[model samples]
Target: MSPFCRKVRLSLAEKRIECELVEVRYWERDPDFLRRNPAGKVPVLKMDGKLMAESSAICEWIEETCPEPALMPATPDARVEVRRLVQWFDDKFHSEVTSNLLYERVNKKLMKSGYPESRNIKAGAQKIKFHLDYMSWLLDHRRWLAGNTMTLADFAAAAHLSALDYISDVDWNRSENVRDWYAKIKSRPAFRSILADVVPGFPPPAHYADLDF
Candidate 1:
């Protein structure tokens, strides 16, 4: 239903965990959906006779269950930094960028909610530059957001950025470092499924699926 779901999806793909993609219009408030997630979220993961909700928690379970190609750092401090950045993207970025842009341009139509507010769209578009600038600043100093190696923080950031990129909202030319970083992640095997996604009434730009882009 949101970038949060994509965060979980990317985690599962990164770990090579074969799972079914269930499309849920959770905003409809279906009773069965509520049973899976009392909050009626679309990212509920049911596997191994267990039902999981909340994107962050589900990601943690995936990490502990499938440690191969670990997404967390070895040292406690590094891991803390990774988690901190994950929250930065998931909470702060979501509120500032994704909610304003993706929700306005995409999710509203999907939910039959209403016409997108121009002010919100403008706000999202304006706010994304700051977030992208912040990403550029981080990449200028390190190979990855949290450290040298990519971590859950990368996936969390990618989850939101990729969704925005799908709408052609990301200005990749703004920063070479950020563009290079995104190119690397966008080419990963884990990103293949996400790149292929298409929403009704909203077609992606050609560069959205172009690996060379």
Candidate 2:
């Protein structure tokens, strides 16, 4: 529920959607959690007493429900672009960076498992360069990752990037455009709660929460 949950939370905040934060230990396989989401994932949104799962689906639901300060663009083409980038971050970037760095370095220890797999960690570390480069390429050509307006794509990318930044895996120096883009997003009021998150046994880097950084 770490990166995924954080993504949903940030989206909700950005859209001014409010909900009670419920911490679900998915690994524990609690019955209550299973009932809410058979997938046993974090960030199961309970809105109007209706349960919702999957980060992307939940985000879309939020967007449809609360349209103010829209996370998706108004035009069809622009909306598609936003969705595309959202998938890129949640699926590709999450698998490459988040699962490797955050889950290996932190989650395993929290789960009372053995040390992290060096191979996975190495692969993730290596793969991140390619993703960061892709982001730089996108930012270089557009005002935002998806388009001129801030959209769900920004939140999706920021969610994964913030998690990596927490573990000190992101090389912001490699891409000034990406760095500047993140700095703008980080300065938003919606990002305040996420910047303050402190995962147990894992301390964020000094600049992780710094808006000026």
Residue-level lDDT of model 2, residues 1-213, one tens digit each, is 387888899988987777678666789898988888898888788888788999999999988888888888898988989989999988888888889988898889988878999999999999999999999999889999998888989998999889888889889999999999999999998998888888777778899999878
Residue 104 Cα positional deviation in candidate 1, in Å, after optimal superposition: 0.6
Give the best candidate by lDDT. 1
TM-score of 2: 0.96
Model 1: per-residue Cα lDDT over 1-213, one tens digit each: 378888888888988997898889899999989998998876899999999999999999999989888999899999999999999999999998899889988888888999889998898899889988998999989999999999999999999999999899899999999999999999999999899898878889999999888
Worst ten in a row by lDDT for model 1: 1-10
Q: Which predicted model would earn the best TM-score?
A: 1
Error of 1 at 65 (Å): 1.0
Off by over 4 Å in 1: none
